[model samples]
Target: MRWGRTPDSAVTERDDDGYADLRSYAAIGDGRTLALIARDGRVDWLPLPGTDGHPVFAALLDAADGGCVELAPVEPYTVRREYVGPTNVLASTFTTAGGSVRVTDSLNTGISGRLPWTELARRIEGLEGRVELRAAVRPGTCLGQASPWVHETAHGPVLRLADMTMAVRTLGAEDVVPGDRRIDVTYVSSPGSRQLLGLVGTQAEPLVLPPAEELDAGVDRTIARWTAWSEAFSWEGPWSDAVRRSALVLKLLLHAPSGAMVAAATTSLPESLRPREGVGGKTWDYRLAWVRDSAYALTALFRFGLREETHGAISWMLGSIRRHGPEPRVCYTLDGELPRGALEADVPGWRGIGPVVSGNPAGEQLQLGVYGDLFAIVALYVGDGNVLDAETGRMLAAVADLTCDRWQSRDSGMWELPETRHHTTSKLGCWVALTRAVELAEDGHIPGDPSRWRSEAERIRSWVEEHCWSEERGAYVWYPGTDRLDASILLHAISGFDRGERMSRTLDALREELGCGPHLYRYSGMAEEEGVFLPCSYWMVSALQLCGRTREARELMDALQDTPNDVGLLAEMLDPATGALVGNLPQALSHLALVNAAITVATTS
Candidate 1:
């Protein structure tokens, strides 16, 4: 299962362009926060203290000022990276002309739950001959607002920027130099030698440094926890490895304190790798949790036999709605508060893409899809023999009532487009909500007027059939007035909205119009404009399976799985032409779709 060259093989060196490809990065997390590690042995994107907190190492956005930590050989080398077994611990092997070294990276976690403070541990082991290692830490503020200063501490040298402080500890290093806004360390190792470098971060609090041995032990403990978690996954289906990896990625995005799952780890990574002049305004902050994304993730987790995460997420969603208001917002912070509105960053974004955003504006949009997402998760929960409390039942009924009143109105739709319209997908989502609510009421799972809910559901079905279907297009249009096609309607087949020939025809239409190879655009006219949406491609896999195209479904599943980076991780989108990863890394929706699609292929084929 090892990758890269053997000890006897002659190795050559390759130079890195300083800017690491998004696909060349792997993620490690402790359920509280996450850090992105490139194959070149650098920690690029980390939101210290909290997953939703401001970034301390955002080199993924602005490499110069957006902080980073590098601990690799000063000379160029080839890298072979992969996770340690099924755990989130990432191991990267560097092969040079002189020797080879293996570096293991992890965001330390405990067996009980997330640890109190954030810590990133890197352990280097020399495989053969002698190797020289260099390490550096450059601290940057949130969106290039301030630079860190070295503050000599009793324990070690601490990097401080405003209220944030981070302590760095090293083992077996020759010298440690503190530079302006950075710390540099150099060391040498012989065969069978090991060294540990650890960084612990805190916000406006006293920095406590743990012993090097203790921090090193934390890496082993974290790996054990991840292995134990992966062992509990009950999936023995197709693409089991991919499914488990996706599950692990999804777990990384979960805020254990609040049981809220964020949409992605990093925000403002552009949707396209093209120049900023061409694709400047499309960047957004996705650190917040969307009701739709969390709902879908919950459903996928349930299918994987993960009860704790499923129930935890459901409880969080219900509690958040109750705490915020009766109506569901498009998105919320990990703690259930509405996002503070969009804030533009001063620094250039990833690859010089400008206007890096901090907060999401979609929270204010009325996306009717939230109703369906909420009810759908509840339906799956209740159907799995779980009981709902009276308070939750009342909340569900109130949501149903709200859906009945708003089903006829215009909305921003699932994609959160600006122009409001009676999006067919929105109407269908309302139909799903009311239909599930009526079933829950009839089954005594929740208190509601089943007859009224059923009436509205039937009305929506009739309205969509009359207005949304385009006879000329031979498939469902994006809306009543537009003849455009949307990839989202492919979910109707899985939702039982229309499992007959019409949905099959819709699947074909989507493939012909939106499909690029196996990947697909979110909607029409997105071909040359944006990267292909990864989740939509997975949706096509499920849609194909439902349409009796089992062989094609499996083929598409294989193609979709192949699209992940070398480490088996998917971003939100992929460059249609170059296949480079675009948008946020470790996208929860993309992983969720992969898990669900694998399940579909297993069950159908």
Candidate 2:
């Protein structure tokens, strides 16, 4: 059914099984973890401390079996909700015939912004007249498995298990509803009074109690802190408001203390439309950090003058690389452990999307572009006059040396597919890594084998020109043996590997093959299995800028940006025919590409 505050032109409908519209879930997190809060005042997805931690609540997977904490008017009422200020603290108003009540939801802030200890507090304030209130505290199915017991304690109700304990408090409400894996209660409040419902985690330890007054102050302090944090951003351009809102959302996704950024706040929101039957496997856990994503994320953070955050990400990446050792892993846990394999959840997936997956399989894949990504980031800082220490310089040289030797070998490429292929884009990535290596060496920022890097990068260039070029199509192919037009070639052009006639020819070829309306797909007429990639369109915009095709780049960017949701959140892909958002929602890579492409266009055009 149509509900909550959505864009004016948006449409909503209940599915056959009476599911709420999936789009109503707004997200809040402490950077290391995330929670999806629905319009009805229920939080569905919250991992306790780390992104890979067992979820405290997981209604995002199976609504009935998955647990949630809900607050609302006991009597029938209309609902309205919005974020309080620029913060993730959400205020939802319940209006009954007698009066109205506004309940605010927030994850408590640590003193002066320490992290890993999470507390979610809800407060209901009566307005105008007496309003009846209702609450249900139910938790089940953590880490894709259901919980064992639902207990009613002397103080309050508790959901206890091996790993999680959520003690909840309700004021002006009685536990009237019986237990059936769901906790329900109702009460009445008069005007000029208030009630609080607090959900705090003990992490299976004895509950530590913070007094009601302190908890309330904590909530207020949190609101103020986020307000102060948001003011640091200064935007002066078209779509500033939208841009600011997006930037704020992104900031909320960062783990404040650790400075590690998550790719998205929700997992398995689905990347396809085929799973209308609710089979439960489409959801992929995105809470963990990806090297590629962090690389791009740091760049965006730096662009906005959030240098501390960028440095934090840099530290995390470097530490993870060191821990993982000589071969850098593609993705890792927030705590820097390499994930084992994909986990299939037992719960029914969101909207019939089968197999809500936990832990990424891509972690095991061999993606060769990471070296290039790392080098590009480090070189950017060095070019800005930041000095690289001797160890960091040695690491950069080692990475470049690896690139020189391995760029010719077939790998998974940027997409991390199952098959290893001679990917043209990946070879170009090698070119970028080596080229930056040469730049750093020449600038005296690092002691690298510049001559070797230049010679090796030229060897890769010669290989691409000889084997990857398509005489029939007059543009570079996706792989050595394939004539398919892949959108990744746009990145090759934008990276300054081939910016002259070769780039112009590839640009025309990509436009002819990959362009769907104003946006460009990752490849031409790919099968359903591969999906339509949106980031490639962003790469196209950057390529256009690098090639002096400013008008096309601006036009394409404007058109592609319209695909994001009302909150200016972008998905992984968009269907060419129906314009439906496909792939994962709120993709960090897509947004990073957008921000960087905008910067490129502004500086160049």
Candidate 3:
């Protein structure tokens, strides 16, 4: 997307107050942490040290008291940027009448065994005649609670906040004199002139600050490493470039030590069209992990030839399953611990949406579809000829037994709402899990009572056919009672069950009852809460493709997947009528479904 021109000289002349416009923001983070950098050159939303840490930069909370780091051009310059190559290394080109500058930023890769440090490196090379630049450097501590002391050293001056130390290594700036949690400096660069600025934070232990030259070398090495990683991807598909980028983003979001992938790199961005709600209570600290996304992420990684992430996430999931028993929590922290349930924050929501939340309340909800999701992940691995170990086999059998016992019960289903129902999709999930488990057992991949599993699978299928189907509407209802059409039933269609004339009739009924302008809502607007679920709409494409309607499926897929933001990132929900992004951002499930839908259409066609 195009970016706004740099702020007017006056705005840059002082520490500007207020939040950065949503359109101007970009994200960067280590796998374990993330930072939001706006086009105006402010690092506004970093959770220092780790994803779960309190913000060292809390502009996402109360823009006034929330801290940030500012780096910007001195004069007016329009901005445009993208990740460098396929890596998360961000490059922004700033252009003005006199000259231009391209600034690259990233958190340098962690060494195999090295001290912890957060690095921000800025490189500026003049493009034309000359450009005068002004920079204001500020660092906040503990959610803007304490001011760091700045001291001048021979290498450069250091900014220390309690035990954490940030050493700035550069040649062309004045000393870092403190002012209201801010530091100011100015510099000028002619054509071909360059400058490198580095910020490194270290713990209270005896620290050895690397030399400026070594840090420079480290930046080059980090880029090279990212390049090699991208080059190793084995993806070959119609959306290979997009898939590769998504895979890279997934990689960047993966916490390697723990084998968890975060839903997104940011929190507190808004779902409503209103920008004010984008700030506080609207915030969902996505730094945690969800089991549903973990299974899907594992499959996606495996598809792109990243076996390590696949294996690691599965190992983590299995351990979690063993610990929590047959029923899995909807999500957990990176370390696989249960959440304390969702709570409303006293802080204002993102923008103005009230109740910035910490832990997800979905953790306690019974999303029975999770059974099938876990089964599908393991089934995919086994289908690829991988062996299932005894421990993992027990986990699969337990999941199957749980499905047999609870499949008929009403549940929150995959949506995680408060109202429970004998959701058609939940029963279908049980069918899927049992069906796959039987297949694995029959193939001697897992030790299970195949006859019992087959009987349970048939039982679910029979119940869905008899009860969930609607003779009046000529389709399957959202739940057992309501005639309201639901987009989630598309899951059943894609799962290879009941692909008969009746299923076709249901697809047509869905088109009329629940379909929006071009997309499909999760269900009719009769429900007071919930935005249109975008991923379910995409699931329609997969269903249609699997049902032998390739042309319609491709058309719908094109329309639905085209609704992402400029950078091809989708939110949790999109306005069915307006196609505007609503709900949470860069949703992993949405994108994962997109990739899978594309794959299905491509292969089947």
TM-scores for all candidates?
0.96, 0.90, 0.88
lDDT by residue (tens digit), candidate 3, 240-347: 655676676677667766887676655555554443422332345566777778766766676677777787787877787778876876777778788776655455
* Residue-level lDDT tens digits of model 1 in 14-63: 12425677777789999889999877788889887887886889888887
Q: Where is model 3 more than 4 Å wrong at Cα?
A: 1-17, 20-23, 110-115, 136-171, 202-208, 274-283, 526-531, 560-562, 575-580
Candidate number of the best TM-score: 1
Report the C-alpha displacement of residue 158, candidate 2, in angstroms.
2.7
Off by over 4 Å in 1: 1-17, 275-281
Q: Which candidate should be chosen as best, given lDDT against the real structure?
A: 1
User: What TM-score would you give candidate 1 relative to the actual structure?
Assistant: 0.96
Better of 1 and 3 by lDDT: 1
Give the Cα-based TM-score of candidate 2 against the true structure.
0.90
Q: Model 1 Cα displacement at 568 (Å)?
A: 0.6
Ranking by lDDT: 1, 2, 3
lDDT of each: 0.85, 0.71, 0.68
